[model samples]
Target: MKGNDHLITAKAPGKLYIAGEYAVVETGYPSIIVALDQFVTVEISRSKSFGSIVSKQYREDSVFWRRQGDQMILDNRDNTFNYIISAIRLTEEYAQTLGRRMAVYDLRVNSDLDSPNGKKYGLGSSAAVTVATVKALCEFYQIPLTKSKLFKLSAIAHLDVQGNGSLGDVAASVYGGWIAYQSFDRNWLMAAHRQQSLTELVDQPWPNLTITQLTPPENLRLIIGWTGSPASTSHLVDKVAISKSRQHETYNQFLIDSKRCLNDLIDGFKNGSLSTIQAGIQKNREILKRLADFSKVQIETPTLKKMCDIAVAHSAAAKSSGAGGGDCGIVVIDKNQNIKSLIKRWEENGITRLSLRVHPVIDLAKETK
Candidate 1:
């Protein structure tokens, strides 16, 4: 088999959910997410000797890996590299199905979402890395890349490692910009994985998954504030998923209200309904709080609550982003209101305001000449 000679590089941005996470995971409801400028980049070029995978932040330990038949055999026992490697293995396997042979190459992964001290920002690093690596490997093997195809491949790789995730982050990374995503059917995915027929999962368009592009009105003001803490989205989601099974009525009402709130907000984004948008944001926050109270999950931590309080004082609506044990909060100021006081109040309360905007996905593989 001829080795891939093209030096391909791909990058994907991290994501922050604006509304409805736990509910999305359970019933495959829609959630709004925005891709950030923070990204994970993977560069693939022909290797001289053997295949190696390296990371920018974790430079201390590098690993040598070989693809045999359909599996990736790595020398290192560290599971930290599983995210990227899982993507590598799946991409190679999928390429083989296209009658394309795999090649040995240097797959270098890098990211800027981490602190200098190696602390994470809870910006969906795993999903970003998985998406970027998958894209890099597919392009390296001369496999055609599409957003839908990329989403399916990336989701399989991520779920193979994490066991469970909503894949909202993966969708945001793949499509970029502001997106409303409905979860893929977990049962269908599990069945396919168990049967070792993941390719069967992507024979056509995803039946249960829905990702739509949406942009906020120009008059609305957006502010992102971080708590300087990384929250485990899976942990918080699991808590709600488990407890919600028993509390049927409460969870059902939450689902109904959550759907309505997001729909109203989406309508507001399409139109210039500032009051409707603000109302929906606050309504969603209250429903999430009620759900948290019933499920015994602290979806909104103390810091997030304080952030929301400050935003409220400034005549803005705020809510905890993502799963939210402790993480960033998104503030949507009605009209073109000033957030200087809101930002100042956040600083006074020790909250960090993160400057993040919608990052449209760029085709780096195509850009490489």
Candidate 2:
């Protein structure tokens, strides 16, 4: 664990999508993301074996990857390790652009975000792992990585495997903390991928993306409660897309309403207007319910509804966060209020309050040094 130039380690935090889940995937819409203290850590050192980069993770001790003519070839047979392999492939390709070869290193990934009994918390772990892996590999090869560069590389890797994500999670992992982000153009990126010339895209100016770091407004405390389950964000997003295709007017109205609510909330944060913030959160919750009614999807399950109702009874503004069918619900509470009673109430209702803090960093490159 002692310091050495040869041994490189990086940790990236998981994220919570505070607002703008499905809408932010569009080119100009904005989303709010906060990095959590829970993290994925990657540690790398020179490998004992030659001609192969070895990876070790939970239960799968030895998976090796090698390169042949710019293509990364895996020496194992498990889809469980695809994310790691994809990160390695993208890193190797990027290093080759800079006239350096990716080195063979023993890379190990571990996470501290799981529950005591090994259940996932839906805290953007994949994005954190991919970001950490990219950082570890780039450092091992001595290739300087800026925030923009890291985002591009991480997005490319993620896209290659997952196919479609807003990359808001990627942004959160690369640049930690509470941030307002606008999605980049996926079509342009897909074209770059088709050309197999990521170097050009990486070198090009970044899209007109805005990622601003902000502190929680005064006296505002964030309350995160888990429903003791996981919901597939992709599944929910795809379902919404299906609805959007058919219910164009409904989806459009929902967009306008959400955008208005988020703008007011963000402005309130800047101006220190707690009332405006609370109102915006409350209205957004109602809007979400209406969207569920329109789409006929269970966006807020009974458990989430109960959690939000509990928060409201405690004089807090609450809603199910992210693509919520079964996952966490976030409550915006006043710090001055006694939350002990509310916590007990939540527990009695089968809701588990989670301990999370924001991970703050502005520029990824500046922070790496």
Model 2 bad stretches (over 4 Å): 1-5, 50-57, 67-70, 206-208, 362-367
lDDT of 1 by residue, 1-369 (tens): 134686678889998888876777854687888899988999988875578888888887788877665566787887478888788878877887788766678888889877667877788999999999988787788777778889999998998888776889998999888888898787877776677655676676655789988877777777888887878887877788788789999889999888888888788767877677788888889989998899999988899999999998888888998888887888888656777788898999989998777787555445433
- For model 1, give the 10-residue run with minimal summed lDDT: 360-369
Judged by whole-model lDDT over C-alpha atoms, candidate 1 comes out at 0.82
Would you list the C-alpha lDDT of every candidate in the order shown?
A: 0.82, 0.80
Top-scoring candidate (lDDT): 1
Best by TM-score: 1
RMSD of each candidate relative to the true structure: 2.3, 2.5
TM-score per candidate, chains pooled: 0.94, 0.92
Task: Please report, as a residue range, the 10-residue window in candidate 2 with the lowest summed lDDT.
Answer: 48-57
